[model samples]
Target chain A: MSAVGSLVAGSLAFMAPLAPAAIGGLATEYVGALNIALEGLILVGAFSYAAAGSIAGPIVGFAAALLSSAIVAAGADLFSRKAKADPFVVGLGVNMLAPAAASILSQAVFDTKGVAVVAGLQSAMALPGLRYSDVASFAVAAAIIAAIAATPFGTRSRAAGMSRDSLAMAGVDYGRVRGAAYFVSGLACGATGAALAASVGAWVPNMSAGRGWIALVAVYLGGKRLGGTVAAVAMFSLLLSAAAAAQAVVELPAELLLSIPYFTAALVVIVGARGSARRSARRRAP
Target chain B: MRPGFRTRFHIETIHDAGGTKAAVRLVAALASAATLAALAAAFLSSEPSSALRAFFLAPFGTEAAFLSTLELAAPLAVCALGVIVSFRAGHYSLGGEGQAYAGSFAAALAAPVLYEALGPASVPLSILIGASAGALVAAPSAIGKRLAGADVLLTSILVSQGVIFAVDWAIGGPFRDRSSNLVAMEALPRGALLPRLAPPSTLTAASIVALAACLAAAFYFDRTRSGAAHDLYGRNQRFAELQGFDVARLSWAPIIAAGVLHGAAGAMMALGARGTAIRGMSGGIGWSAIGAALVAGSRPQALPFAAVLFAWLDSGSRQASILSDLPPDAGQAIKAVVILAVSARPAIAALRRRR
Candidate 1:
């Protein structure tokens, strides 16, 4: 394949994991919670799905990943609702806790800390050089979009975040909705792990590879529009692919290349924020 | 959106703070036990008793373990004090990780350069450089929050991650020491290093410095007028602004100061124990500091105990990993659960108060 073709393929590969996460994060974003544990959830999926997939089968692996992540999300939601702690901090707690637990489990079970190869995985279903994960990304994304636009619970989740106390004080079962949002996030993250692991045929520690954070960035940058969120994720994944390409050619430091996504997110925030502020200021002025 | 007790857990119900302290402690202890029990059942079912013993008692089993724990606690306590300061000022900066990494790198790079020109004073000068590096990294968030109303939490993290990546590359690539087999930078000479205060362990005067930082922070928060105003502003922004406090300055100053404190803690790590900057050496010190701060209720006075408790968790985990089959990161899991358990204390109190 040509370099450009390969880059395009890589972009799709990057987008496959991140798209589900960004879509899932929209659920949490709506419910006034940033599920910073998105990364941790993705790792849980990457590890468990692969481990189970190799041992049992893909379907069972997928279920195991989803179940495990849901349990974690449930705990995070409980802490957010009952503990009254900063949900962001709680998210960070879960992020730390997940990997630590996964690593310990891996050590006990697999006897390795670096990578666990999923045995009995047939292959990445590919045609014309595009993997199954790429197609699956779009399928899952469409479902998420349809759910958000058509569901009553989605509207409630959106209302929950509009103010600090409205959802907390509302007559609706907002806790359940918020909890469901977190669970949805977990489910999406599970799909993300399964897709990525299927392509690579191994569960690499830290396999989420900052995609969780990048997904959060995309969700925010998309500004509540599903289409906009997809576009944002595509743009980010393309930039990440381009950066990887550039690192191969350029003399720049590898770490700097790795940081391009985060730096781009920061720039997006600052520029987007300033642009909005300027427009709002003009609208208010004579 | 309301800055609700950024660091301290305010669960007062017209009751004495004293009464709740015991309640919080009891709840915290109970939560830790529950968490450990759960972990044991799920992960350590093979040899739970032995693992628990190493995790709990091994840190104090030997003088070496005890002093090493103290050494680890020094940086954590110093960084936790930084957390308290920023949280008290209503600036929730999660940039400690990047700040500490930047500080360590700066100290390592600057100490060798300044040793010849400044001689013995290079120690302090190198520390100042580390602090400045941290401040430089943190300044954008403070400025963005003050001027543009951009959320500091988001900006600080983004900026921090960028800096961490940059520093990681530099330490691993161009700036790495060519002579050393280890992935570390040039070691600071003897005069630039922190002098050891205790024997048989790497206990240095930096530990005293860490304690002094906590004491001074406690004094400032409890006794000073400026500290009171900062606290009031952090708790209620509109009320503080109406009361004629400089809320804008309050927003920025605390963040910068916290960066400086985190930098100093990083400097202590590089200069005190490692004597050189190593890639990824900052590890989880930043998160651990935040954990300590949260468990301490963001009170400077209580930070030392919180730091030591967490330090024990870390050292004990290592001991367990070495003496038994338990892996190193199991300690991290236990510590995280313990932190969550500790934070639950105030929440339970707050829930009861609400009822």
Candidate 2:
């Protein structure tokens, strides 16, 4: 493959892990409520993938991931809306809780501190023609984005997010819409977690690393638009791929080099946000 | 005209009613407690009685165990104190882990070098070097937030991951100790290590320092003018601003203070662990500190007691595994359950509200 093609392939693979965040962002943009617990949701999904992959098949593992994510998301939503707890705080708590739970489970079941290798799930394959699973994941993400953008529910969801009261006044049950959106977000997160494990062929504790947060950055950079979010993910993935590819040639430590993509993404978002805000202010001024 | 105006006002009243703040506080508290209870139950069932008993009581059963618990809690208490300050100021600095690691790395790098040059005086110097390194690492995130409106949480987390990876690379690569089988740097000289307060136990002078720091923080947070200003800013930034408080300046102070405490904790860990900075030597203490702060509801003075309780549970769990058939991991599961139950009390209350 050409250098560009290899980069693209690597980027696509990297983007697979980010699918959950993009999907969650799409839900928030549509539903008018943010799922602040995306990090926890991802963690739970990852653990569920590991656990279910160990006992049953990948299908069961996938189901477990989706179910676990939904439960966490729903719990977060319920707490935020009904209990009146801060979403951010509760989300942080959930993030802590997920890994601890996963670590304990791994240790109890497999006598491992961080991971468990389940051959059953590892052997799970994609449809024969697809060749690689990442291609399928990217395809699904694109489809979800396209479908959401083209739907009326999506339009209403975005409107609700902008102003819940305004949407409510228009006869939409904003709470119900938000609840549904969170469920969808959880499902997406779970799918991403399972896909990530499947791709790696093993489940490592805290495997999502900071990918969920990275996706959030991508969402911000993408301006919360589906196309833009996908583009941002693609851009970040490509950057990471390039860094990884250059590791052998560069004398720098791989870990420090691995940090380049994250640092670059954060810097780009910061700089871009400031510049755009300034440009808009200039345009608004006489 | 008057009737029409009155009818419009009545309609507006209904709209305003919808905006009435939900009883979220009561719900949050209940949900948290329920989650803790459930987790505790799960953990208790998963382990044998002896393990459960040991997990809960071993740290308090003997002096050595108690001191060891304190040794562990000291660093966590210091780190959590920093988290509480940052969180109170509405700044989520998740980079404590990273900052702590940077402090550890600096301490490790400096301990041997400083010991050779300064001889007996290297201990304090190594600590100072570690604190400075931690502060430097944390400064970028603080500046990013203050200058560019960047989210401190994201920046700090990113920086922390980068720093951790860098530290790991340093230990595994250039700084690799040829004599040891484990992946760690060269150990510091005997004089460089913190003086032990108790024989055979890991408790050291660093624990006393940590305790002093906590007491000092309590004074600063409760009685000092700047601390009061931080409290005001934290509770309501807009209100503080309206009251002519320098919310931004006051907020920055706490964040920097947090970095200092986290750095100190890192240094203490290095000293207590005998100079070598092991991977995850902080041992999820940063996260637990956050948990402790949350459990204490950001009351700085109450942190030590909470930290001790958490540390006790942590040590006891390990002891229980040794004494019983249950695995050591069961103890952590129990702790997680306790936290979950405490945090989930509000969710249950919310469910009640819905009904």
Candidate 3:
């Protein structure tokens, strides 16, 4: 394959983990409760995968990841709603809790808090430059996105965010809709985490890194539109892959190289916000 | 003008989130934290009672431990003051981590050279340099918020994370002390470091500074006309605008001021006891400061006590790790629970209905 072809393929594989998270976040975004705990959920999923995969197998790892992340995410949502807490604060709390829980579990189960290699993961499934998990994650994300865009349930969920009272008056439970959204968000983020760890065959501390945050950013950068979010995620993945490619050719600090995508996202968000502000101002002018 | 400030900004003012309600929530949060600490000890340790005892009592066990707790609380108190400032001004700036880190690195880098030229005067000067670096990092978010209507929370975190990575590279790659085994910058001159308040305690004048800052902040917010304007601006920007206040300046000034405070706190971490800029030193301080600020109900006068409480939990967790082999992150779990609990608002209607 040509270098360009390889780069595109690699970027798609990179998207395997991130795409699910961004798509999942999109669900919560429509429900008017952004899941700031995407980061934590991803970590929970990855740690669960690492632990379970090393013992049972990759399939079991994925199943455990899905179940654990869903539980945590759903539990946090229920707690926030019942306690009448700000979901955003609850999300940040989850972010802190996830890593601590991961570390504690690692120490308890694996007797190490640094890294736990998932043996036999490498031999489980492989494609030219991708793993089966990568394709599976992509398919899952696409299905969720399609469901969200086309389903009547999706419309009600979106309405729940935009006008909760309207939905409540319409006899739909806003809390229930949001609760369901959070569950789906958890499941997708779990898949994201599992794929990320399975790709590397090890559970490194903070293995999810900031991918969850990136996914959240993608939700906003895509203008909160389904197509735009997908495009945004793709763009970020491509930039990451390009940076990885550039490292072989340029003598740059790896940290600096790794920071480029975040820097670009920040710049884009700022500029986009500014342009929208100006446009709104123009529209309001006599 | 563009909908009421309540609808448009949606930044929770201290008035909305704090006071007696905050106090009740705080007590509940602390109790939950203790319960969590106990559970974690029970699950993680061979000797659960010992672990629980170490976690609950060790921070107050010895004079050294007490002083260390105070020392940890100082910077936290300072950072919480910063968090309170932005939060009160209705800007949820989440860039404290980056701001503090940039400040620490800047102070560490400036300390040695400044000490060579100015002797003891270098300490404050380096701190000032650190504050400037923090302000530089935060300016983009503030400006973006003012000019572009950008969300301060998102922009601040994005800018901060990027700065953190860049700073990490600088600390680990170029500025790293080759002779040292740690990923950190060279130590500041001993003269440049803060003078310890008590011998062998590692406690410095930072505690005094923190106390002074809290007092001054309390005075400024409660006893002054400008502070009233700032508070009003936070609670209802539209009303403040109608009252002839400069809403434009108020929108962004508090965030910059917060950057200054966060930077100072970061500088204190380097100059107080560490005397060096260590990679990841600013890791949990930002989040913990937010927790401390919330526990204080965003009230400056209450920040010192809240900071000490958090510091005690931190110290006790460390002690537990040493005494009973409890994982140190158990402290973090307790803190997370506290933050979540304190932020909760149990429905008055529901409570009355239950009654």
Candidate 4:
């Protein structure tokens, strides 16, 4: 394959895990909440996949990851809703709780807080040019698109954010709609974690790194549109791929190289925000 | 339509309505945090009694431990003051971690030269340089928010995270002390270090600065006309505009001011007993400051106490880990619970209404 072709393939593999989490961020965004805990949720999913996959199989591991993440997401949402506290604060709490919880569980079960390796399964579903996770990620993105475009839940979710009074007048339970969005976000982040762990055949502490935050950035940088968000994710994944490739030739420190995606994301958001503001100013003038 | 950008949580300073209610809530939250810590120790440790005692009592067990805890609180108190400044201006600057790290790096890098040139005066001057570095880190977010209507929270986190990695690189790479075994910069000049207040304890002059800052902030926010304008601008921009306040300056100035405080806090950490800019030293401090600020209800006068409370939790956790088999992180989890509990005022009010 040409260098360009290989780069594209590399980006696909990288995007496989990240796209779901970014999409999950979009799900929460639609509900008028910024789920900052997405990063922690991804961590939880990675740990679950590694722990379960090593004991059972990849299939079981995937199921467990999804279930556990969804439950955690739902539980957090329920706490915020019931407590009437700021969802953002509760999300921060979850972010703090996740690593601590994971470390404790890891030490209790695996006797190590560093890494948990999956047994007998290393990219078990590799395709000709793509991994199983890559294909599954594509499928998940498509399903999410279809659900939002075709389902009543999507309309209600958007309504809960954009027109809460109208939704209430229509006799819909706004809280439930928002809760469902959190559940979806959890499932998506879970998939992201599963893909990340499966690719390495192990879960390292903080394996999610900053993918969760990057996904949050993609949500806004994509202009809050699903397709735009996916495109943003693709762009970031490409950056990651490029950064990885650059490491071989670039004399820069590895830490600085790793920060490329975050820097680019911030730059994109700033530029995009400026453009939007200019357009708005122009619209107001005439 | 794009949602309008806003701060994640509302700011309720000491002058706000329901001061008594806020105090009650804070006390309840602290008590709840203590209970949670005890429960966690009981569940996580083989020797539950020892763990509980260490977590609840060890911070005040010895004079050294008490002073060390206060020393830790000094920087945290300053950081919380930063949070209050930003939040009260309706800007959520989540970049405290990065700003603090940048400040420490700048102070550490400049300390030797400053000490040579200015002697003992380099201590305060180095802190000022640290503050400037922090402001520089926050400038992008401030500019973005003021010019483009960008969300401060998002921009701040992104910029901060990126800066954090960059600072990490500097500490571990080019600026790293080659002779030292640890990934850290060369130690700050001895003369530039904060003067220790107690022998064998990390307590220093930073505590006095933190207390003075809190008191000064409290006075400014409660008594000055400009402070009233600042608060008005934060709570309601339209009304402040009608009242002839400078909205533009208010929008950006508080954020920059926050950067300054965060920077000072970082510099203090470097100058305390550590006397060096170490890799990852700024970890958790930023978020904990936010928690402390929230616990104080954005009240500057309450910040010192809140900071001490968090410091105690941290100190006790360390003690528990040493004395018993309790996981050190359990204290952090308890702190999270405290944050959640403190912010649950609305729910508590609702329950009261129902009753």
Better of 3 and 4 by lDDT: 3
lDDT of 2 by residue, A92-197 (tens): 6676667767766677677786667777565333432222445545555665675567776677777776688888899998777777677777877787777777
Q: In order, what lDDT does every prediction score?
A: 0.76, 0.68, 0.84, 0.83
Name the TM-score of chain A in model 4. Answer: 0.96
Kindly list the per-residue Cα lDDT of model 2 for residues B117-234, writing each as its tens digit: 8886888888888877777767766776565556666666667777777777877788878898877778777788887879777888877777787688768767898777777676
Docking class of 4: medium
- RMSD (Cα, Å) for all candidates, in order, is 4.2, 7.3, 2.9, 2.4
Per-residue lDDT tens digits of candidate 1, residues A88-159?
A: 667777877878888877876677877877675534656554566546655766677677778987788787
Q: What is candidate 1's lDDT per residue for B186-286, written digit by digit as tens?
A: 87798888777676787887778888888898788778988887888777888888988888889789899989988988888888889989998988788
Candidate 1: Cα lDDT at B9: 30
Better-scoring candidate (lDDT), 1 or 2: 1
What's the candidate order when arranged by decreasing lDDT?
3, 4, 1, 2
When 3 and 4 are scored with DockQ, the better candidate is 4
**Residue B57 miss distance in model 3 (angstroms):** 2.4
User: In angstroms, how far off is A195's CA in candidate 1?
Assistant: 3.2
What would the TM-score be for candidate 3 when compared with the true structure? Answer: 0.95
In order of appearance, the predictions have TM-scores of 0.89, 0.86, 0.95, 0.95
CAPRI class of candidate 3:
medium
Best by DockQ: 4
Error of 3 at B279 (Å): 1.3
Of 1 and 2, which scores higher on TM-score? 1
Question: Could you tally the backbone clashes for each prediction?
Answer: 0, 30, 0, 0
